[model samples]
Every structure is written in structure tokens, then in C-alpha cells.
Target: MSKVVLVTGGSSGIGKAIGEFLQNKGFVVYGTSRNPSNYKNSKFPLVALDVTKSNSITQCVEEVLIRTSRIDVLINNAGAGITGPIEEIPEEEIKRNFETNFFGPLNVIKAILPEMRKQGSGIIINITSIAGYMGLPYRGIYSASKGALELITEAYRMELKPFNIDMVNVAPGDFATNIASGRYHAPAKEDSPYHPNYANVLKMMDDHVDDGSDPKQMAQAILRIINTSKPKIHYKVGAFMQKFSIVLKRILPDNIYEKLLMNHYKL
Candidate 1:
């Protein structure tokens, strides 16, 4: 039988690209969107799912299993971003950011792991970000969400090793996508102290995404990862400079790295 693949947030952007790529590779792909009807014309079948809600995740998995009988791979790609100064970002906004980016994936994983454990084999891939390594200016909540997922992925890898399950964290620096249009902007008052720099830095971040590598490249990298019998625990996909930035962080002192980051973002 062909392998079954489940991808969350598969309606558009990187998730959609990965779904299409894997479908073409002959896997039985079931992509999820809160409103599957939105992607009725998509190549792969769309399953209704809202990762933030536990019941929605359970139902989505059940629906997929009814058709495919088994799931061989699960890709946690659903996420959202909140950009603004930390002080200006409301508590609810931070919680919502984590809801979609971190907790959403956790909910899906919990729902799927039972079957994976039953089969004694499966692969789980968490789509993280380069920003996860360190908090980013004007996007602290978004970075924190991804960082939380990264750490969860690390722990799950070790715990699931004996169950014949594999876990991976795919950290993309930036990918040309519609993410900018989807991101939430923290309310900034006219008299807010960080107003001047917040607007410029947020625009800079969006522009960085616009100039990022092709999503198809990220899709291809994911395919390669899926094919590996024993994939690495972590993978970085992006430009040389972006990937090197992570390396620099590891080798540089905190004071120096902080300066480099501030300069690079023009903060």
C-alpha cells in the first residue's frame, strides 16, 4: 500500500507546496485547512481541521483514517505570526500566537501518536523557523512560539525513538509566501515609545520574507527528509547567510551576537 501523509495548514503557502510535492511523489496526501472548502480545487484532498481545537483535530484524524487506513507521516506546518514590540503586544495576542504555532501542533501530535504507536512506526516533522533559535525584534511572540515547538520536537525525538517513530524540526529562515499578509500586527499607539522603530522593523521583516527562497525549495527539502530512513534531528533550509547566522550564534559570545542581530535587522 502507498504511504499515507497528513499535513496541517495545507491550504496555502509552504504547507500547500509540500502537500502537492508529496502527492506527486505518489503518497496518499490528506491536507488540512480550517475550511477545506476553500481549497476544493487543490490537487490533494482537503480535510477540515482547526488545529487550535482538540475536537477538530480528533475528527480530522478519524476522517483521514477512515479513507487511508493508516498514517505514515505527519507534518505540523500550521502556524501564525505576531509582529510588534513586546510591550505593545497584548497578552491575548501572545496566547493566540502560541495557540496556532505551538499548541496547535501539540494537539495534532497527541491525536495522531496513538495510531503511530499502534503501528510502531511513523515520522513527525515540525515546521519551525530560524527565528526560533533566538528571539527576534518586533516578532518576539512569533519567535517564542516556534522556539517552544523546537524544544518539544527535541524531547519527542528521544522519547519516541524506541517506538520506531522519528521526529524532526525543519527551520526555514524565510520563504517567499503570503505569510506577511496573514501576520497580526500588535496595536501601536501614536505616542508609544517604540512606535518609530516598530513600523520600520516590521516592514523590514516582511521584506526579508518577500526576498526569501522559493517555497518549492523548502518542499523539495522536506521530500528528501521523508525519504531518509533515519533523518537528522534538525534541518535548516534557506540562504547561506541565513543558515550561517545560526552558526554564528552558537560560536559567538552573547554580547557580540546581540549586536550582530540588532545591526542586521537595523534596530
Candidate 2:
């Protein structure tokens, strides 16, 4: 039987690259999007899924079930960003971020675990972020969402270890993707709590994304892991700064790291 892989948010960006890479390796790939019309790429089995909605997830899983009868792997690569100060973002925005980034994967796991448990072998790959490690300025909500994911992944790995289901997290520090552009921007409040500082941090994030790692390289790395018999529970990919992001969090004093990050984004 051919192994099957389903990649959420696989219409474009990193998710699309993962879809393409896995297809070349001979996996039956199913890439998902909210609206089939919104996706321009029709290379794979493009299924209908909106991570924010449980009904949508159920529908997509149903389609996968009818055809494949078993899913070998699930890549939860669907997520959005909200770039703004923690105190400034509205409660609604935070809730929505959690819904899509945190609960969405949880919902998918719920729908698919029965199948995975029955099979006695399956993999759940989550594309988390380096932000899950250290909170970034103007990204409290986004960071929190991914942090929640890290915890969720860890817990699942521990509990499911004996069940033959593997849980993995790919934490990318900075990547060239449409993430910044796709972020949900709440309308700015004029002369409000967060203005120029918010604007500066957003710009810094944009600058990094533009010069970040090549999506193709990241895709290849994922393929390498897929081909391996034993894959690590977590893989962190980035340039020097990403290594620094973690090291600084550990060795450096909190005060020094705060000043360093602030200086990195200083106007």
C-alpha cells in the first residue's frame, strides 16, 4: 500500500513546498485549503479544509477516508500571524489566532487519531515556529499560539509513544513565506496604546522574512526526515541568529537578551 500524507495549508508557501517535495518521494499527497477556488495550484489532491472550523475539517477527513482508507502522516502546517503588541491586540483577534493555530490542529488530531490508533502506526508533523521558544516583540498573540502548540505536541508525544504514533515539531526560525503579508491586521487606533513602536516591530519582522531561509531548502530538509527511519521529535532550522535565539534565552541574562532584541529592532 502507498503511504499517504496530508498537508494542511498546502495551497502555497511552505505548505505547498512540503506537498511538492513529498509527492516527488511517492507519497499520496493531499493538500488542503479553505476555498478550492482560492488555490491556484492544482497539482495535488486539493481538499477543502478551513482549520478554524471543525465542520470543515470533518468534511475534508471524510473525503480522505473514502479514498485512501488510511492516512500515514498528517502535516499540520496551517497557521496565520497577528503582528502587534500584546496589550494592543483585541481579545477577538487573540481568540481567533488560538482557534486557527492551536485548536485547529487539535481538531484534526481528534478526527484522525481513531484511524491512526487502529493502524498502530502514524505520524503527526506540526510546523511550529522559533517564536514558540522566545516571545518576540509585537508578536505576543502569535507567539502564544505556537507556544501552545509546542506544549500540545510534547504532551502527545509522551502519551502516544506507546501507541506507535509519532509526534514531531519543525520549528523554523525565519523563512521566506507570505506569512507577514497574510497576517490579520487589526485596524490601528490613532494615537492609541501602540502606534510607532508597533509599526517598527512589524517592519523588522518583514525585513527578516524577506531575507530568510529558502523555502526549497526547508522543504528538502523535511523530505530528508520523511525518508529517515527514525526522526527526531523536533527539528529547528535557521541561520546563526536562530541558534542565538535559543542560546541567548538560556545563557544570557534576561535583561541582556531583552536589550539585544530591542536593539536588533531599534529604529
Candidate 3:
């Protein structure tokens, strides 16, 4: 039987691309959306899911297992975006971002582990962000949440090794998607100290997405990883500079790397 793949937040964006690509490649693909009815035209089946809610996660996983009897791959792609100066972003918004980007994926993994363990095999891929590798101005909250997931996956890999289960992180740079429409932007108040800079950064961030690479590239990269027998713990898919930025951070002096990012963002 073809592998059964579950992609969270798969109704659109990177998740959608991955789901469609996998389905075309002969895998049984199931994507999740908060309101599955909204995606009646989705290429693959979409089950209702609100990653931040435990009951929703449980129901979605159970429903998939009931139909497929096994889940060979779990893609933790559901995430939220947040942008604002760390101090300016409301505490609740920060918590909510974590609830979606970090806790949500972690919980989904928890929900699926038992079934995978029973099957004696599985691969879990966490869709993180290139932004997670560094603290970007105005996007600090998003960076922190995704970065935390990256670390958590590293820990999970070791713990799941004996069970023949694999976990990996795939960090993508900007991709042309509707993510900006849903992203939480802490209002850039004209009276506030960060007014103009924050506003400019927000615009720049949106433009980057507007000009980003095709989401299909991400789908292809994921397909390659899924086919590998021993996948690496982390894989990054994006433009040269975006992937290179992570390398720069590792070798460049801390102050120098920070300067580069500041210059890039024109901060």
C-alpha cells in the first residue's frame, strides 16, 4: 500500500503544495483545516483540525487512522505568524503564537505517536522557518516559536530512535502564500517609538512573501526527504541567501552577523 501522509495546515500554502504533490505521487494524503468545509475543492481530503485545541487534534488523528489504518508520515506544518517589536507585541499574542507554532505541533506529535509505535515505523517532519535560525526585527515572536520547535525536534529524534521512528525539521524561507493575511501584526502606532521602523519592516516582510519562490519547490524538497531511508535531522529549502544566512550565523562573529541582518532589513 502507498504511504499514508497527514499534513497539518494543509488546506493551503506550503502544506497544500506538499499534500497535492504527495497525492499525485501516489501517497494517500490527508490535509487538515480548521473548517474542512471551506476547502471543498482541495485536491486531497481535508479533515477538520484546529491544532491549538487538543480535542480537535485527537479527533483528526483518529479519523485519519480509522480510514487508513496507519499513518506512515506526519507533517507538522500548521503555524501562525506574528510581527512586532518584542516589547510592543502583546503578551497574549506571543502566547497565542507559541500555542500554534510550538505547542500545536508538539501536541499533534503526541496524538500520533501511539499509532506509529504500534506500526513500528513512522516519519515526522516539522515545518519550521528560516527565520527561526535568527531573531529578526519585528518578527521576534514568530522566530522564537519556530526556533523552539526546531530544538524540540532534535530532542525527539534521539528519544524516538529506538522505536525506528524518525523526526526532522524542514525550514523554509519565504514562499508566496496567504500567510500575511492571517499573520498577527501588533499595530504599528504612529505615536509609539517604533512607529516608522516597525511599519517599514512589516511592509518589507510582506513584499518578501510576495516575491518568494514557488511553494511547489518546498513540496519537491519534502518528497525527496520522505523517500530517504535515513533522513537528516534538519533540512532547509529556500533561496541561496536564505539558506546561506544560517551558515553565516554559525561562522561569523555574533556582532558581525547581527550587523548583516540589520543592514538587510535596513533597520
Candidate 4:
């Protein structure tokens, strides 16, 4: 039998690519989105799921159970972004960012844990980003959301180990996606601090996403995880050059690492 898998935000971009890839591999793919979707055709089921809302998430899971009666894998990929200076960002926007990026996965994890625990077998993959590891200008809120998610994924992995359920985190570097285009673009509020450098920071973010790696490559990485029997708990994907930043952080002096970032990102 094909393994049953559930993916959130599978309507487009990386999620969409993943759903297509897994379907071709013969897995029963159920992609979740907040809004109704018909893009995946009749072969794959595209279920409506809004991670921010408990009721919405619960209903989606129930629907999946009603259809397939089992879930072997879960991928929490639904997320949003917020861009602006840390000081100028509104408190409510930060909360919203966390709601979709962090708590969204938390809710999905909660919904699936019971079933996975009872079965004593399952894998959960959380789609995070390099921003989760290192903070960057104009993306404080987005980075914080991913950083929180990284810690949450690690803690959950430890907690679920006893249940025989595995948790994995996939942190990808810049990927070409509509997410960058739709970032919550809030310039410095009038009379707020950080008026200077706001445009430059946002511009850099824009440029990175515009020319980043293709979404299909990320789909391939997700496929690699699902097909592997002993799937790794964490997978980092991106240009090998990204390793330089990781190395700089680990080996270079603090001042030197900071300078490297400034020189690299043109900050």
C-alpha cells in the first residue's frame, strides 16, 4: 500500500511541488490549504485546512480520517512572512506572524499526535528556513517565528521519541516563492524609530527571493525524506555556499562574522 501523507499549504510553491512529487511516487497525498483549492486535480485530495484556527484544522483531520482512515506522515509547511525593522513592526503583526508560522504547525502537530502515538509509528516534518537559525535585518518577526518553530521541533522530537514517532525539521535557504512577494510589507510607522534603512532592508529581502533557488528542488528534498525509511531528524537544503555562513558563525570571530554578513548582504 502507498504510504499516507498529509501536507499543509500544498496549494502552491514548495508545498504544491511536494504534493505533486509525492503523488507521482504513489503516496496518498492530502494537501491542506486555508482556502478551497482545485489545482491538484482529482487524483490528489486537496483538503481545506487553516492552521491558525483550531476548528478548521480539526475538521480537516477528521475529513482525512473519514476518507483514508490513517495518516502515516505529516508535513507542516504552511507559513507566512513579515518584513520591517524590529522597532517599527507592530505588536499585532508579530503575533499574526507567529500564529501562522509557529502555532499553525503546533495545532497540526496536536491534531496528529494522538493518532501517531496510538499507531506507534509516524514521522512529522516541519518546514523551517535558514532565517530560523540566524536573524537578519527587516525580517525580525519572520525570523523569530521560525526560530521559535526550530526550538519547538527539537523539543517535540525529544518528547515524541518515547512514542516511536519521529519529528524532522527541513531548513531551506532562499527559495523562489510567492511568499516573498506577499510578505507583510509595513514601512516604519509615522513617528516610529527605524525610519532609516527600512527600504534597503526590504529591498534586499525582495532581491533574494526573486533570484533564489527553484521550488522544485525543495520538492525533491521532501521526496527524499518521505522515501527514506530512517528519515533524518533534520535536513538543510540550499546552495552549498550557504555553508560558509554556518562556518563563519562557528569558526570566525564574532566581529569578523558580523563583518562578513555586512559584506555579503550589503547591509
Better of 1 and 3 by TM-score: 3
Top candidate by lDDT: 3
Q: Candidate 4 on 100-147: residue-level lDDT in tens?
A: 999989999999999888888989999998887767777778878998
Candidate 3 residue-wise lDDT, 1-267, digit = tens: 899999999999999999999999999999999999998899999999999999999999999999999999999999999999899888999999999999999999999999999999999999999999999999988999999999999999999999999999999999999999999999999998998999999999999999999999999999999999999999999999999999999999999999999999888
State each model's C-alpha RMSD to the native.
0.9, 1.6, 0.6, 2.0
Q: Report clash pairs, candidate 3.
A: none
What lDDT score belongs to each candidate, Candidate 1 first?
Answer: 0.91, 0.85, 0.96, 0.83
TM-score of 3: 0.99
Q: Of the pair 1 and 2, which is ahead by TM-score?
A: 1
Could you tell me how far off, in angstroms, the CA of residue 69 lies in candidate 2 after the best superposition? 1.3
What is the C-alpha lDDT profile of model 2 across 66-167, one tens digit per residue?
989999999999999897767767889899999999999999998999999999998888988889888778787888899889878888899988888888
Model 3, position 263, has a per-residue lDDT of 94
Off by over 4 Å in 1: none
**Model 2 lDDT-worst window of ten:** 185-194
lDDT of 1 by residue, 6-78 (tens): 9998999999999999999999999999888877799999999988898999999999999988999999999
TM-score against native, each model: 0.98, 0.94, 0.99, 0.93
In candidate 1, list every pair of residues with a backbone clash: none
Best of the candidates, TM-score: 3
List candidate 2 stretches off by more than 4 Å. Answer: 188-190
Residue 185 accuracy (lDDT) in model 4: 83
Quantify how close model 4 is to the true structure by its C-alpha RMSD in Å. Answer: 2.0
